[model samples]
Target: MSERLNGIEAFVAAVEAGNFALAAQRLGLTRSAVGKSVARLEARLGTRLFHRTTRSQSLTEDGQAYYERCRRALAELDAADAALEAGRLTPSGRLRITMPEVLGRVLVAPLLLELGAQYPELSFDAAFNDRRVDLVEEGLDLAIRSGPLDDSTALAARPMGHQWMGMFASPAYLAARGRPASLEALLAQASAHRFVGYVRDSGRPPWQFRDAKGQAVAFTPSSQFDFGCNSLEIAAMAAMQGAGIARLPVWLVREALDQGRLVRVFEEPQAFGYAVHAVWPHARAMPLKTRVLIDLLVERLVPALAVR
Candidate 1:
């Protein structure tokens, strides 16, 4: 029974870590030991688990089926462990999470650090990225996403807060170019003004706004002076430097607005914005650590983002 358990642990670790060496590192076991344990398990099961190459290992069909069952079984065991830990009221274990780079660095990281200081037993492995990731495939424990989430039974989501899109410019730029009184006026003189556009996989995105009737609209400005940036921080910086007007989330530029570095181009509030969510894989029992973090995020982040 002990040997069987060891083999199962090795196999699961290898899959999650993406290689034997890394799995060994994670498990604090020698690489050769991990490989041998998996080999023994395969020999007993009478089927090949991995299609191995010198550089990489991919799961075989049978391996994929086995892994799914094993993962669920392990989750059940983890739930049992978490239940016991809940009584102690202390969360221990590493949480693997992901979030957008700027949001993670500016907001989430500080919150997590505070949590860590409060709970000495807790640890974290975080990935700050902009691209969407599959939580299960990536073995992530949680994700903080901004914008709409696709419907999925495999995961659960909680709304953290929302961010409003606002058009902003530096005082110098606004003084020189003059502010457009309305969205229509801005569109009419789109060529006369420059824009700092946000770029993604689909290229630069159009600035989002809402019509008087509360209908969504997009404005794609055209100007040789306009430039594209992949980072929101950079776009905000460019706007501060008087390069061009930028469409940015209100929370991101709140400090600049307060410091008189950036001014709102339009006084009317725009209804166009996106909801933020705290997402995690669905489980029979939620880990105490995950629950604690989620609660903290709601307590701290919601209020911060809620303020206009």
Candidate 2:
């Protein structure tokens, strides 16, 4: 039975490593030895754990179920070890996070480095992509999201702040075209101005602004241009280059506005506003490291993005 525990561990390592040779190397045992350990475990369980071919090896259905249980058990063991260590020292573990690339590069990277300096025991595994990911399935500690989050029973979210959408263009563009004095004037000059637009989910061409009173305002774009990007940072860049009026988050274009490279248009009617949030899985007992990271984000991010 004591040998059986070793066999179980070997079997799990083999399944996770996706190959017997790799698993053997990881476990610091010969390939033949790993095979024997797996065979012993399979014999005891009365089932084959893997389906192997010349090119590949994959877990059987039973093996997958068993692996899930074993993985959770191993995770719990590691968590207990960390918990004991945490009491004696600062939180120490790898915290995996995901966020948008532009925001991550512009904002998160510096903050995370500072955090690392503060807590030398903590480390980060951060990836930046615009695509939505399943936090639990992907084993993510946290994700930064910009917009309304769908209702999910499995996750909890903390609102960072709200972002207001506004239109901006380079000073050069405004000087060339002569800035429109009113919304109606802006709409009239739309045909001569290069207009940057977003492809909405509903297949509508681009977004039109409506006032708080719900009055639809149309800006007849001079020339319609679509770069087919979902990132506001990219669109704002186009606007800075004098491409045309771009509807983007005010937060993203603040630096340009301060430098006089870009000027806000349509100050009277605010377009759409979206909320930014930090989302994480709702676990029974959230890890101390994750809690600490989330707190740091909430404290730092809110002030950094405070409405000017």
Candidate 3:
């Protein structure tokens, strides 16, 4: 266990320093020792973490994946030690955060409000928007992201939870254009029904489903509406207005579902190949306030977004 921990510590130090020599300086070891430790870790995992030659070095695919997890884990460990040493009950800091508009307002804001009451010294500078701001450029401290973080090399993220996308429409719309009894029916009469497109960084995401065996299938919405949106609540509103069928998070439409304003089609849970994450810049070690907030978010978000 100590050996593995040493290897991980060496690996993270090297990655953060962007080279073994600087990592050696930071870790108080020889460059050769740091390199050897990383190599040992790679051999144990049976996967190469880096591609290094005399002139160039870069993280391998496996390395990139592992590095993200390791960096966050190390930050949490460092933060726990700092918090214990600080020996303070009330956290005091101004946290700058960003999140999607609807989620920020509907789900996250309430939690923050409750947390504020817990630690009155803690304050927030938040931006609720669909636009993905550069956290570093904006000097943001934390962000709750709901999709792939392909461009997150400078960020350390922890999976908080995920929301399921299910097909739903206003009761009136379903009544007018008979309910899609199954996935096949939904696709077959494609021209008869319109769909609200979900715009993402990769472009408009298609409806995703899982077969009986739980293999994923992506179905592009052929018939469309006048609007495409990035906001869950807005897309749901379009469906509620009978503009089209929307594939949206169930939480956004739970009230509508209960009130019979909307009805879910095809009794199954589906995904758009993504999950939610709470992220902060990699350069900063987690502070006591940030750590507590992340803990609260994970504790609350998972159950709130759980598929029923």
For residues 47-144, write the lDDT of model 2, one tens digit per residue.
98899889998899999998898778767866886776568557678889998777776777788898889889999999987778999899999998
TM-score between candidate 3 and the true structure: 0.70
State how far residue 113 of model 3 sits from its true place (Å): 1.7
**Cα lDDT tens digits for candidate 1, 184-278:** 88888887788886788667666778887888888878733276778899999999999998888888999999999999898544567788989
Model 3 residue pairs with clashes: none
Top model number, TM-score: 1
Candidate 3, residues 216-242, lDDT tens digits: the string is: 888887644456877777888888898
> What ranges in model 3 sit over 4 Å off?
1-87, 151-154, 200-203, 226-230, 269-273, 283-285
lDDT (Cα) of model 1: 0.84
RMSD of each: 11.7, 13.7, 9.5
Predicted structure 1, TM vs. truth: 0.72
Worst window of 10 by summed lDDT in candidate 1: 148-157
